[model samples]
Target: MSATRTFLMELHCEEIPARFLTPLWENFVHLLEDKLEAWFPTGDSANYRKNAIDNSTGLYSPRKLAWRLVGLPAVQPDQTETQVGPPQRMCVGEDGKPTIQGLKFAEKWGMDFSAVRFEQPAGKKEPCAVVTLTKQGRPTVDLLAEALPGLIAGLHVPKAMRWGNSEFEFVRPIRNILCLFGDQVVPITVDGVTATNTTWGHRLYHREHPAPVVIATPGVYESALETAGVAVSVEARRTRIAQQLETLAAEVKGRVVADAELLDTLAEIVEFPKIVRGDFPADFLELPKEVLVTSLREHQKSFCIEGPDGALLPCFLTAANRTDDPAGFVKAGNEWVLKARLYDARFFFAEDRKHPLSDRLEKLMALTFQRELGSYHDKTGRVVALVKHFASRMSDDTDHIDRALEAARMAKCDLRTLMVGEFPELQGIMGGEYLRHEGAHEEVWMAVKEHYRPVGADDAIPGTPLGCLLSLCDKLDTVAGCFAVGLIPSGSKDPLALRRAGQGIVRILWERGWAFPPADLIAAALRVVGAKATKPTAETNEALMDFFRDRVAYQLELAGYAGSVRRSALAAGWEDLVDLKARCEALSAFAEDTRFASLAQSAKRIGNILKDEAPSTDFDDSLLAQPVEKVLAACLMKLELAPDQASLLHALANLAGPLEAFFNAVMVKCEDPALRAARLSLLHRLRQAFLRVADFSLWQ
Candidate 1:
């Protein structure tokens, strides 16, 4: 074996979209790292694998991605080979010479006849014959030549494109492939482009002598690229951009308001950090903050700045590809583009409010929610009904219920407005704003605004009670509508994001501790669905409840509940998520006690014993022949359950000793018929007490 060293690969292509750059680079590196470990587990890889595979930074910028792996063996280690063939008795005839079978085997294996030797068996009388084939391991560079391109192909991109006359498809057009193994080029062709050790820097940023810089070794890649004016590290680039934006924002007594996703996208779109401040008309600030921020950030790839008091300022920051912007050309261009966008937004805001949001409700009939689920108008009616049901669960106040129903009635009206038609993300916000413009109540419009509060796990839930009720109703109506039409989410495929809605439901219920039965709400929602549904509602109710059960289990699992506890709670049947969670908590806590181990074992034993015996709920004390049977029966009859899980668990805790003794003394399968029936009856009673919590045997 030869010594190990580092390998490098850099792929430069046509400019990749900001959204595709990071994921493409990450997917390629992940697949390539797995290939590296599996192909070359060298002697030094044992100590440095963590740093090499997981911790190594992936260097990617616009149009380029690269990786430098250390401690990679030059070639695979040699391995021994053994092949077993026919028995020795069959290989040689009675004359003790090679038979026709032996010659045929030798010919088939492409080996000399004399090389097929006989070997004796350790425990058998006859000797078995074997043949060994020495398979030579290939060079690491050669293996990489075969594996790397396929690994690159395995990267997950939404779509691939064809460029020029090449048959190969990739996210973008390939311009260069830089592959180096210990300073030597590992040559391979991908779509007519051959890899070399030479790489190019930023096309126009460098002031150096030439841009085609040669990386002498993999260890000095960053330094080499630095000379070519390319910042290869994404972290360094992001920090540089963030620091610049902060400095620029502080000049105006404001802070940069950029999300993580926007920053990441900006980080991928530029090779060198260059941020310029631009301004728009102050009248644009009159529009909703979301409209201004979305207009700037979504299309222009810029950042919004906010004053200390939370009001958005007139200035925005846009990243540039080049640092030297003479005469402020980039700034002037960005300012002009933002001015036009704000003018359009100002127009949309004006035209949308001319008739008020209420008038848009009649127009929603032309817009269908689904082909068979009727229009958004019909959905609004069902959502109003569901809101009434959910609001009654928490508060009996007439005002609260009426406000929630009124909020639901106006929920989907914004979809028909002009502002929402232009900026779809401002649906709820525009609705609330329009309602406030009409002098509606705060509770009504606030609920309308926040009904979609939590679109994901990271998002915030509704703050108001009316908002919470309306959100639940809206999500449940969508889920019921989809399920009624057979649009159920399958494995890894949720086209309608039903999983998010379901997760949001479980999160809200579990966090708020609202006392509502999930089954009853699901049935009620289905009733609303059944009335307007095109298909029969016979199976949709049961199917949706089952989906809810699976999601509840998933939600609890994610909350760090032990699988055993969840199973135990689910064993009782899932009707209410809050109650199921409470029972699981009580049972999990009880399992930690010292007395629980023996009782659980006894509980498990009771189930095993009753497996073959016919169950009888009727306990005949007249047939009792033992003292333990009478004691067990007496304790079970006195067993009383309270409304709370803790109280029930406490009652269950008392019977553990008596039940343990009954199993210790009384043989359930006695010879006499009456004694056997009596003992089985006693065990049956004990089993019923445990089932109040869970199928305890399942926990064991």
Candidate 2:
């Protein structure tokens, strides 16, 4: 028996990018756990490994990544090694003595001939000569010393660089390595840095305490860092920053504009957080709310504060990695920098308002959408045409159709603006603001602004009918044009974000309950793209439809639909996404009924029996010989064609009893070919009815 101990390891380096910290820490922890589990496997060793992983904590900041594991075994469990040799016939002679081949086999395994025994391995019928040996467990400290160097060197980050004269590549230069097993240091070296039990504190806050802090044990690692003005735990730092932001915002009778992403980035970039509130000129509020927030968040990494009325308060909060700022130097510097950015934004806004949004349309001729797809000017023409095609199908109001067309024409004009040149994230948003400032129609301006909604998985779709119409046209044109030019997305190589664009299209259609078939939409988009399409129309149409089907399946899975239900519904028909969703929900709800399994199995059996036969519903009822066959035929005829999906599912479930009885009592393949054909046609009719709701043959 061996006692359990705690293990800790830390890598101190130059500041890593804020986005790379979380992923690097996660991979590092996962790799360590996998290695430890593989090295220690046995009765008590399993429990110790489980405890270590369950109690582990990953510490990550821009400057450090560390892990602390508790209850790890001090030594690996003993293992057994087995070697198989020549077959029994080769190893034994007629008198049951060792043959010359057997002696060499035993010598190869470093065992005496007497130690070899005849045994049959599992799953093998013949006996073979085998030898078994026991290996003693090694100390955990020794294993760590041998594994740590390679593990540290193999950590992956998006972009890595080499520093100084060393050939080692890392996200940042390694300054120190700290490792400990219980109270003893683990002697390991990574690149040129050697492991120790000492770590430094916050670079700025702990300048007065320049000496390194010695960690006596894994149990006191976090507390030791805390005493030296470093908060080692990421969650603790985030909570502290959040509380400081709220407290400061409350002091000025305002609330901090909540941005979870910014909070996370700030947490990763700081060791200790101190919040400072700074003010800009109230005239900056004349700019749109989005511009103010974007400038503060993107340019300065600061948080905006809003008044109780939900309007901008002209104040912002910035988090500094320090204990305090008694003279307000940090606050002054942040305020000055933010004011300069706001001044530039105001200038751009004034200049952009000089012309109507429609006047910028000609500027798009210089911007290429894609080399094969012509310029943004050409794309706008396609979009306007697509909007007309889709709008006519969806609505009859001429005013609505004209508004969508107008929005399509001016959507890409903002890309040429100075404000958008500085902040590319505000492309669609700035266009809408300029339109509104020039007294454009409310519907037109809003439609332009929201055309790029649902940019990612968790984002919202366009809020208005016209907005959704415009968004669909824009996204569809891009996807269809790219597919036309043979730029389809494959594997992970979607440089144009075709997958995201496709998903946005599906989401907008499904969420809005629009009943357009995917093929029809693809055809319309291709027609708008006209002669630019090089691929055959039928081929491109098929590939685009399959792509849309995949997006629909992905979205359904995210919404918690089962694979069987999705496949069954999709196989029946996926022309209308709204109808597909309804069928899926109906099938899912019906799955809870007591008769579901029998009905599904019956449908599967019918499909299998009629696999290659194409039988029509016009079967001769007079040829039905058995009573069971007649009863099934009558039940099929009596099935009420229900208008709603749930009623249809219930109607399908009613055939289970008759189907079971028919299969049990009747044999379809008879001596008379005509009789067999009639029975097959009857079964085909039943399968067709089931196909209306779902292809139950695909049911698990």
Candidate 3:
């Protein structure tokens, strides 16, 4: 039986950038789990399966990433192996004792000459000397000493830099490493820092509380750090920050509003969180909510507070590292920073509204959107043209069409605005705000505001048709522009976010119930932008269609459509996403029937039979030499398939009996060339019918 012990390790570094801290810890812990499990798998699979996290777990704060494990064995189990040497005929040489070669083998394995026994063979009547060697289990501390350093060295970040002339590079320079098991310090070194049992608590807290926190035992490390004013539980620290923010919001009659991403950033930036609710002038609330929130969260790392009536409050909450802001000095300082920020917001807001969006159009030409694809000015014109073309395919309402075109023209003009320049995230929102202030049409304002909807995977689609049209138009033009410059996304690199644009296009049309396929519009967009493009129009048009098809398959896959169904839809061709998706779903359901498998099998057989031949459907009926052939040929002519699934399957099922009989009775490759051609032609007619919905060969 192996003795189990708890283990602890802390990588204390110079304040790691808050963004890199979480990922660094996560990547290191994942590597640690795999390496530890491989080298030391718990034979007790039952317990290992029940409580896996206890085997290895991690926590992180601004300057530290650490882990504590329970149930780690004290040492590896003892192992024994045998090595064979010279035969016994030579060993039992003259005196019925070991020979020189056997004695040499005993010395090689550190065993006595008498202990080196000889193994006798049954058939050959020969014997050989064998040395049985026992390997003692290594101490867990020694094993850890070797592993932990390599693990630390292996940890990487997005932007790594070597420090102090050392070849090792990381997000930041390592100041100290603490690795402990029970009460013993594990010997390890990383980037010139040696491991120790002693660790310092919160940096500032150490100044007043000056004693070093000795980790007497691995199990008590976290609690000891807590006593020294440092938090070790990443989740608990995040929760405390949230709870304190909530308590502060109640006193001010407001609610703390923050995205999960912002909260995560805040949690990693502080070890001991102290919430400070500071107020600014109420007049600054007149600025857009996004401007106020962006200024606070992005700049100060503070969360915006909204009052009970859903209005922005003058106050915001900041999570500071210090526990005590005695005499309100810190609170006053925070208020000063926010006031200066909101003052800038107030200036950009007032100055930008002074001019209509049209006045900024010429200014857009000066700033390049994409060097190869021309300017945002050029993009605006293309989007307008594409939106009008898409609107014609969508609805008969010219009012909405005209509104969509106008919105597309003014959409990116806000990129040149002073307010949007300072707060780039407010590009579309500011465009809508400015257009509304200038008494633009309500539809145009709505279109501008919602044009960037469904920004991410789960983001909502536009609520209005005009919004949908404008959004689709904008994304399609970008995709076209990228393809025009021969910048199609390959592998994981999508610099222009073409995948998101493709996904956004699919989501809008599918959600808005637009059955029009995007292929034609994509082709039209190519014509709009592909004239002077470095790449050929035909080449990019093909790539763009393939891009949308992939996004379409991805969307259906997320919707739980089977791969076979997806393959079938892809085979049929992707003209309309809505129509293609419906076909996929119908094929998936039709595939569930037991009889459908035979039909699928026959379809596959038909494909194999006509692999090289271009069998025509116009084969004469007089060539039908068999009754099954006549029945199938007659059925093919009267076969009328509706777009709906049940109708199409019902029609296809009508020919299944004749198809089965035809395959079972007829010999397709008859000696006569004309007869073989006729039979292949009949199979061609059958496949064409299934091709209307899907290439049922995919079902096979």
Please tell me which predicted candidate would have the highest lDDT against the true structure.
2
TM-score of 2: 0.96
Residue pairs clashing, model 1 = none
The TM-score leader among the candidates is 2
Once fitted onto the true fold, the runs of candidate 3 whose alpha carbons sit more than 4 angstroms away are 1-6, 37-58, 77-137, 161-168, 243-254, 307-309, 323-327, 395-398, 562-564, 587-606, 613-643, 646-700
> Which digits, one per residue and each the tens of the lDDT, describe model 3 over residues 41-107?
5465224422434556547787888887777777776667788877877766777767787778888
Worst 10 residues of 1 by lDDT: 41-50
- TM-score of the candidate numbered 3? 0.82
Higher-TM-score candidate of 1 and 3: 1
lDDT of 2 by residue, 180-260 (tens): 999989999877898899988888645787788899899898898888777889999999999999999999999999988
Error of 1 at 13 (Å): 0.7
Clashes of each: 0, 0, 1
Against the true structure, what is each candidate's TM-score? 0.88, 0.96, 0.82
Q: What's the alpha carbon RMSD for model 1?
A: 3.6
Clashing residue pairs in candidate 2 are none
Off by over 4 Å in 2: 41-55, 123-125, 638-640
